[model samples]
Target: MAGCDVKNNPTYLLVVAGAISDGAGRWLMHRRPLAKAHGGLWEFPGGKVEVFEKPTEALVRELYEELDIEIDPAAVEPVSFAQHDAVDDEPGIVILLYRVGEFAGTPRAVEGEGIGWFTVAEIDGLERPPLDVELAAKLGRLFPE
Candidate 1:
């Protein structure tokens, strides 16, 4: 119901929660555990939504469940979005990126293998999943230079 987001195409809404702590602006990312698909891939702290939940609601729940933070709700905003259609013999995914500068509590890996804060420059240095690699670029456009 917002922008040109397609409701189809194996679509996924990737919510990104970012902030600055310790005088450094770092984006929060988490690694998937071994039991899931794309396991071990570093992702922007979120998961898929059930049919009954809104994207924003899903984000708030995910943050509390996965990161132990309380989102302001009023501060979360969409920054950029991308559709990933892999070439050749691979699966395609669409990700909707988001941004926020504020939240409650410290960020820890509450639901996965690891959690870390990465500067925008360091984000590109990590070993990321296929379409997830574009997250930084999308976020850049969202927050601007």
Candidate 2:
């Protein structure tokens, strides 16, 4: 065990995010709370997948918790993913991005962060994490004009 120091290394996380789109083509974005990691950056609405929970299950749970909305698991379709490397002491994360086309209730920022709808072009200018930036690019390819 020459190089086995698990305690010194950050753990990996499985993060599930939704590219929640209105029927008209704009997608939802959530601003990270100032007290959280990646604070002040825009990200797709999602959160970490808990143990024993599937990715889609996590998406539904997270959306409700963060946005105060209900997402039907069947309404979410896997679209793309981003594998982010750990930086500094941060944990590496594999983000699974889903396209949520149908959901109930309005998206309110229950976590004291900003929420907004943006077109693909508008998303290009937002301050987002690298994983979100990649997810946005994939969205552009999926719904090109």
User: Which candidate should be chosen as best, given lDDT against the real structure?
Assistant: 2
Model 1 lDDT per residue over 1-145, tens place: 5665355433444443333232356777788886987888787876666566777777788788888888865777776555666556444555666576777899788888988888767777887776567767676555543
lDDT of 2 at 37: 74
Q: Extract clashing residue pairs from model 2.
A: none
lDDT against the true structure, per candidate, is 0.68, 0.90
Per-residue alpha-carbon lDDT of candidate 2 for residues 1-145, written as tens digits (9 for 90 to 100): 6786755553678999999988787999999999887898999989999878999899999999999999899878899999977778788899999999989999999984789999999999999988899999999999864
Q: Where does candidate 1 stray beyond 4 Å? A: 1-23, 85-92, 141-145
**Residue 131 alpha-carbon offset, candidate 2, angstroms:** 0.8
TM-score of every model versus the real structure: 0.76, 0.89
The 10-residue segment with the lowest total lDDT in model 2: 1-10
The alpha-carbon deviation from the true structure for residue 19 of candidate 2, after best TM-score superposition, in angstroms, is 0.6
